[model samples]
Target chain A: MDLKVEHEMHKRRFSRNAGLGFVLVGLVVLVFGITIVKVRMIGNVPEAYNAAAGLPTAEAGE
Target chain B: MSDMSADKSITSGFENEAGFSDYYALLKPRVMSLVVFTAFVGLMVAPVPVHPFLAFVSILFIALGGGASGALNMWYDHDIDAKMKRTMNRPIPAGKVTKEEAFGLGCALSGISCILLALTANIFAGLFLAFTIFFYVVIYTMWLKRLTPQNIVIGGAAGAFPPMIGWAVATGGVSIESVLMFMITFMWTPPHFWSLALFTKTDYADADVPMLTVTHGREATRKHIFAYTLPLAVVTLGIAATSIGGWSYLIVSIILNALFIRGGWQILRRDDAAAEADDYKAERSYFKLSLLYLFLHFSALLLEAALKSFGWGGF
Candidate 1:
């Protein structure tokens, strides 16, 4: 015989907690997307730096 | 007596337990929409291109920054808000959210939005967002609102910063086009707000906030509104000559400015006695027009930018 009952406070707070959860999750997704874009757009590195780092460059590779 | 006490306790309990909507109300979402739209236009019209995702993030952060400032403003102005009929039902005054919660939320979001915006866009965009929040919270809300009749004039600069910040997010700096966009909003705020002040009657005076209508006489406020429309029209039209402005913007500006100038003229021509007799119909309609006026102008600029993307947008 389970006698567990939800408290009134818990019911009232559910919406706020859910909203905060959604916002946090959305923020995480946005940060992940930004990270991916930033990593992929690293081609702006100067030719000299790329050469020094032993990375291929358009001018040098040709 | 027992029943009355029970009812009071129940109501108090409900009020004390704020829902998510009450928290959202603190952000003044209506104002945030304007911030978001203008900021989007600023980003789109810039000569430089931004990645679609980055642009979305920049606008989101800018809106967050605007909302954070709004929360801070509500926290500080809760006292005045409680007094005014227009604001008495806000989250704070209505006893839904506490002042400390609002302050904490505002500060946290402000810092996070500014820092993340800088990381996502550029240092200039981040710093500009911070400055805009500071200007709205500190300069406009705390310092000038209660102290001066020119409150809207100076405070308008805070609202006008969004487009400039958007431009910075794209180009990482300002330009004539962005400056012109900022000026359009800046010059338009006085007439837009003063017209509202005219119809709302004693909202400002009742709150003890020194709006132009409170400090200056009603006739003076009217004259100022009309006087402002001239310069507002100039700034609105001036943007059409810039790089981002095009045939669409030019036609929109001409028609809107003509209607705006006519609206201002109608407002200026009416006396208070006549206005009150007609239930402030002229003033009320003028305020309504101001809303459409701003929306259309920005929409036209956005349209021009969209066209230019396909190699047909600008002159």
Candidate 2:
């Protein structure tokens, strides 16, 4: 049985994989960008994060 | 051999060979474009401005949500889709994507979009996106689509929510302007669809879907198309009086609404014989106009909002 490795189905499978890779990368970029914007908007450590880190809350520090 | 032939290969028997574009087609990209446009208009027209990046993200998620709903619609309606010539070549009906794949994709995208939109915008906007999906998938697709002649009338609500959801993304709640935007699309759907039905005479009938033309006689559908234009005119024109309204919007609405009403009247006056003789020319023209009608109205609103930014817009 001579099985072909470079069939048209292989091309479609590669395209689908490539598309999924691009989509995942795009999602990561979007999420990172959103996080940066959120952090910039706050301009300080969020109270929950501060509390979680065992640091003074924003109000307490103020 | 070509992929078409390769799809029948012995080794491919166990593996699904659907492509990326097939999955994308499940999203109904054409419909997503309308959702994106309307949602962007809604976001821009809100009194509260959104950050440009946030605005982009919100609109993208809204489009995704809309697309997700389209996928679910396709999944549920693949049977009828197979029957309709317009939809016979859809991913599922064409045998590219299975109905289960479409359903899974729809569910996953719906959840992702709603959650991301909420995290990007606000909870209300996120919740609104989820509700819009539920309305489209469950209410419109599963329940109303096959059961009622008024399917699109009520199902139209699902399509209309994008702009409102966009407004919510900015304002974090519904307002008169957003409701007005919703009404414009809502009232416009019947006439738009019925006109297409007038021309495509057999699609709905053959599919056993209860479209207006299928349930009601041609004359009744014609009359309904004209009647809807009246309210559609009122809503499109009425929005001009609100804060989003301006000279640009006002003038555009008046001209467009007048032409729309005239088009409806033309549709109403024509008989089946006249339409057939002319290859349904009037009906076809009316359908084309209906497409522009919603788009131009929203564009005018966006223009009004843009002018307001420069301190020159609104009443």
Candidate 3:
């Protein structure tokens, strides 16, 4: 009975480690994604976006 | 007594063998990358600008739809996949995952991606994606894959739909640019698969998939490749003439198609006995180059779109 309980505990610990690994990878991807989005939104569109959309040449809104 | 333990050993072996990675492999990430890149170009080239986050979300769902198609394809094709030496090691055929699990995953992802795309992008984008998934899984995999030698030719629409869906996400409608993008991919698929079939017909034959090479012979398949590349060259030029293209794109298209046609001609002109003896070098090189051809065309389009957006190139 004691051996069986230790084996079960070991399985639980392995699963916990796997769960942590997944979360770590997800966090890294999320960070990278946020960085890319920020870089793309640097207000450099200016009036170029407006002229293209035919929205009366002005700064791109949003 | 031994039978139960033997069964447990088999079951436990598979249980440990299948993991998160095996499930991800079922998504066919290489195929998904092509879908994502083409769809990204479509979205980028559209006249309307989608917010970065929204663009990301739209592409995420599109890739998910593609993955759903792949899982369903694996589920349905597992039998033939097991027979084909090239595909015998896929998730299902390798016994890492069950067909029922793949089916469930596909169905779930299909529903989630379709509904989430509708919520995130326009209804038209969502509908097109849903249709793409259904066409790949049912029209291509279920009915046509086993039935026709021209399966890739007709069913190529499934891959071609991604750019159209991406365009719809931005503009909520199709235009000459999006349709031309679709046409480029559509016309390119036959030669692509046929080139592969030239080298791998044995796999198709063993699986009874009736590929062009299996049905018509390698010589005829080579002739078909040469024929298809002719119009494919013209279609590439046709895309360059659209509003989304410019001189740079036109130049790239011309050069790429010239090399492509030259490659096709070499494959068509290769001495069959020599190829048989030497392991089909011409066919293999042509197959590898064909992979680069579509990507270069789309990349050139992306360059044009970038230039035009920055108030410089085009016309």
lDDT of 1 by residue, B49-130 (tens): 9999999999999999999999999999999999988899999998889999999999999999999999999999999999
True contacts kept of each: 0.52, 0.45, 0.03
Residue-pair clashes per candidate: 2, 0, 0
TM-score of each: 0.92, 0.92, 0.82
Q: Which pairs clash in model 3? A: none
**Candidate with maximal lDDT:** 1
Query: Model 1 chain B, poorest ten-residue lDDT window?
Result: B6-15
For candidate 3, the docking band is incorrect
Model 3: per-residue lDDT, tens digit, B1-315? 475565565456335356566777888999999999999999999989998877887898899899999999999999999998888889899987899999998998899788877866789899999999989988999999899999988778788989999999999999988998998999899998888877764677778888887788788988999999999988889887788888989998898899899989988887679788779888888888888889999998899988987897677
Candidate 3: lDDT of B280?
84
Give the best candidate by TM-score: 1
lDDT ranking, high to low: 1, 2, 3
Q: Given candidate 1, what's the lDDT at residue B3?
A: 58
- CA lDDT of each candidate? 0.91, 0.89, 0.84
After TM-score superposition, what is the CA distance of residue B82 in candidate 3 from its true location, in Å? 1.5
Query: What clash pairs does model 2 have?
Result: none
